[model samples]
Target chain A: MAKENKEVLLQVQGLKQHFPIKGSRNVIRAVDGVSFDLYKGETLGLVGESGCGKSTTVRAIDQLYRPTAGNVLFEGVDLATLKQKPLIAARKNMQMVFQDPYGSLNPRMTVSQILSEPLQIYSQRKIINMTKEEISRRVDELMEIVGLSRFFKNRYPHEFSGGQKQRIGIGRALALNPKLLLLDEPVSALDVSIQAQVLNLLDDLQKEFDLTYLFIAHDLAVVEHISDRVAVMYLGIIAELSPANDLYVEPLHPYTQALLSAVPIPDPKIERTRERIVLEGDVPSPDTERHGCYFYDRCPKRMEKCKGSIPELKAVKGDHQVACFLYE
Target chain B: MENKTILEVKDLKTYFRTDAGIVKAVDGVSFRLDKGETLGLVGESGSGKSVTNMSIMKLIPMPPGKIVGGEVLLDGVDILKLNEKEMSRIRGNRISMIFQDPMTALNPYLRISTQLIETIRLHQGLDKAEARKKAIEMLKLVGIPAAERRIDAYPHQFSGGMRQRVMIAIALSCNPEILIADEPTTALDVTIQAQILDLIKDLSEKLETAVIMITHDLGVVAGMCDNVCVMYAGRIVERAPVDDLFESPKHPYTNGLIQSIPRLDEKGSGRLFSIDGQPPNVIDLPECCPFHPRCEKAMDVCTRKYPPVVSLEGKREVACWLYEENK
Candidate 1:
């Protein structure tokens, strides 16, 4: 699974995002010192349970919720310190697709308007000077590229189905032709039938455009299907990062083993017979200052050492990094 | 069949009168549940799994949604023909349903204690103190820790997985005979999903109640269900033992569903092959096989006419022309 070029497109270093609780005087470490690299033209799947800071980390990368402290180097540019204008300028080359397509798109805007506005802003051409005919032509091309028909160009967001609305969202994101896409559970909202269609479409689009993707999702099967390398996030920290094939086949970390064991296999016989590692208790409160591994309380294989020091993510095998005292 | 049948639904059709058309959400669907067995109803969204469950409980709204037809027979009694007085007694006491979204299914304003106890008080005819005691016990039953403290907390205070457990506790308050969970873990993460599913399995063993689990996740069905029912566009496409369904799926739709679920074994074999198209629009569906449009192996007869249930010797039934006697 090793890449020939192996060029890093985006590198996140010690990214920390701590939000102050409304009444309490303590901070909720949503994304506490998370770091990972996104290689060019490759998809890195980020997975975790809800409140494990998977969404918070993606929000930080998309600059929607800026990090409290830490560096986000997109092509060696520090986004943490970038001014408003530069942030806007940088956004032209970066785009996001959210979990809920219904809530993300403006209900009133036509598909052409939604697609054209981004182009109109980035191109800097006089708005009125560009005729309606020209703007629609470009929108149609974008639709066709996304495998959506041009018949949907004039339709409102409400008129289209959930899958079609998602296509519109993809079309809008593609309007800018961004270098990196922070897709946050983009296919989670759709049904399995449509989800597969959209996922396959994404795979084709990635190869066609040579786009880099930061896919944040809770689905292992889908993420493992789509991702090149996947980072398993738990309580705002990555427990394991490895090639998707390796992670599934030979997972090292106890948490990864538990996580993989917990996933029900599609084969009924195997699913019935396989022994599952059930993690104990809910994910510990990130608002509290946690000791040891964030998963120590729930780790089925937790040891006495796991309660003392937080294990660093270190290489256990070729391109496979695991953060656990057992591995250490 | 006397001892085997737990719940039987016959010719149940639930419809919604929308502005566009009358959506036949659950069109002439019939199935039976065995005692202490989990029947997994698998389908895409709008395939009427949820609607069928809701219709059985008579929870469908009057103006837009109506039961329209069929009888929901639980333990030889026709519950569908029963009046409101009878249904209310059966609703939470004999049969309970767990919705997909725990956040919305639970009241944002009320504490878990209040929600759980109110149902117990109404159904079980318990006093305030007695209901409170039962609620705490029910909470503990679902594996929620420190139930005495967590019981009084509102839905917002709990996590997604925990809130779902609360919903389960409420559903199991009266120790119902049947539990209909529609996409119970769809909103939660996979890790938590496994936990909840295991909890359900353990609880089912303890309670010995029939469970109708409706979901799109074939992986979950494979693990959790005793029998799996594949639904497509308001019709049950295939119904068989879980092992038989996965090992030798006769129906094209059933085969497609298993293929669509990405597995570790599928890696380095071939790319993920999706079912070609979406489920048919429920309203005004065509008179042929509902799966004809997306079906890779569609035949002339598949589009011209619908396939009847090709019943096998031991309890397997598939609705595909490929299994027809004439074919």
Candidate 2:
């Protein structure tokens, strides 16, 4: 966890993802001007509620969605400038695990087929040239690493449980031994018991492979558990960013404070006594053009200046950044 | 002194006649809801939490889903014995429900006013104009902005959070004695979920309605409910007050569930307490404790025979072989 010699594996700068409305000229700014640095072998969590553009940010970083602006530099190479073939080649070091285990995997294919299909397809890219026996052996190794029994590889996805299906998904993501793993709500779909199992597995795998993770999730608890550093996003921008512990303990931004407060802790005594800052309104539509702060309408400490100018993410405390007029 | 029991479920056994086998969806589930209280039915998917609620509502299809045995008492009267017409009268009037997804629960083709007014008129016997006014009031009560105008809008016109507010409006339109919300806020955001939960809590308190909240989230249970029932493989494994359940969970399955979830309060040690193995198949559950396979402290007797329910002090109860001697 030492930062002295840690290399920045993924440097995302001024990334913007805008979707054009079908009939109208207006566009939805799903991810607008977000930037972050993911250190090698350290997990950086992206936490936000629904429609806050956390998923879009991850997707843009994964190059699944072509960004409208800005650069995604993976080990100094700008991924946004790459063509389809080259991008595919670049994606070999970066893989993603989705939230829904049931929908992510192919239902028709057996687990063995699902695991091997990735290797077979990527082998055509010539990054991995393996014989049939080597492929089988690697597939089994992936399964074992993910804690899935090798004997259950022949079973269809439908036959396995939610946790098992997720393990298979993780196995497929790790099939190529990617340096960076983009986990988008990996454990959110599983049961609490199974979720913990998967979280522990993810932790062990991180150490075993030195995997740097962009752990994207809505659950604050899971994010705090898995992430070394955490970024709080709201309406397509980073509201606050700091070490995971510091962010949770003393959130600088009002949005981060409100979001952390809104999450109900399991302890009945603490929950009853804790003062929650429940925001009044829903997240505003991304289609609306705003000159001021995106969270101005809902911020508890909104000022007259917040209505006129957008606050940049400025450093407040040690390594902690906040985007608000109060911080300015 | 007898606490006024609004609803009581005794040995409820509901099964689905699937091609695979008779799936014991809700097997011998029992619980009680007092007047103006919230009871949390916590469980994973297929754990029979939803089915138990469906059985109480008489919403289960008879051919596929049959209530083989049970006594569901609403105000000391057994509702399971009631016919379809009588049950229909009870539903949406005395007992109402809000489903999981607001988008799917509300008809997209129909306007919000139409859905709300229809339920209002049918349940309250109000005139069309009067029902429309009442529907708008309900919507406003659930914090829908511009209720008078938004009432005429279709379900698609509203956001996910707003649609959920509409669902709450319809559910609370009749001001029923009991309200059953099945994963009501699961589809919404945390902030939105907080808003909806506050609305439900506030409305239930104001109306003095007993609520049966069926959800998979323990945090929601801790914040909202007075009592909690942890279910597994179609059986209630533990029943305790919310405070007791969270502080010192009794059953092994309950303990595993609490320890498994990462808490927002404190940092974890890079590992979580995990319950190994999947839940047992409901169709052919073992004669012993269904959780024995996954239980860390499972004994030989656990796999040999079913554990009896042990009632501890402070109204806590657990079904596990570890506490078998106390039964």
TM-score of each: 0.94, 0.98
Task: Give interface RMSD, per candidate.
Answer: 1.7, 0.8
Off by over 4 Å in 2: none
Total clashes for model 2: 0
A-chain TM-score of every model: 0.95, 0.98
In CAPRI terms, model 2 is classed as high
Residue B265 C-alpha lDDT in model 2: 90
lDDT (tens digit, per residue) of candidate 1 on B1-327: 235897899989998999989898988898999889899999888888888898889989987998888888888999888999989999989999898899999999998898999999999899999999999999989988899998989999998899999999999999999999989998887778998998899998899888999998888998999999999889899999999999889899888878776775457333667887667887887789989999988999999888988898559999999889784
DockQ by candidate, in order: 0.63, 0.84
The candidate that achieves the highest lDDT relative to the unseen native structure = 2
User: What are the RMSD figures for all models against the true structure?
Assistant: 2.4, 1.3
RMSD of 2: 1.3
lDDT of each: 0.87, 0.91
What's the lDDT of the predicted structure labeled candidate 1?
0.87
Q: Encode model 2's per-residue lDDT on A195-238: one tens digit a residue.
A: 99999999999998989999999999999999999999998999
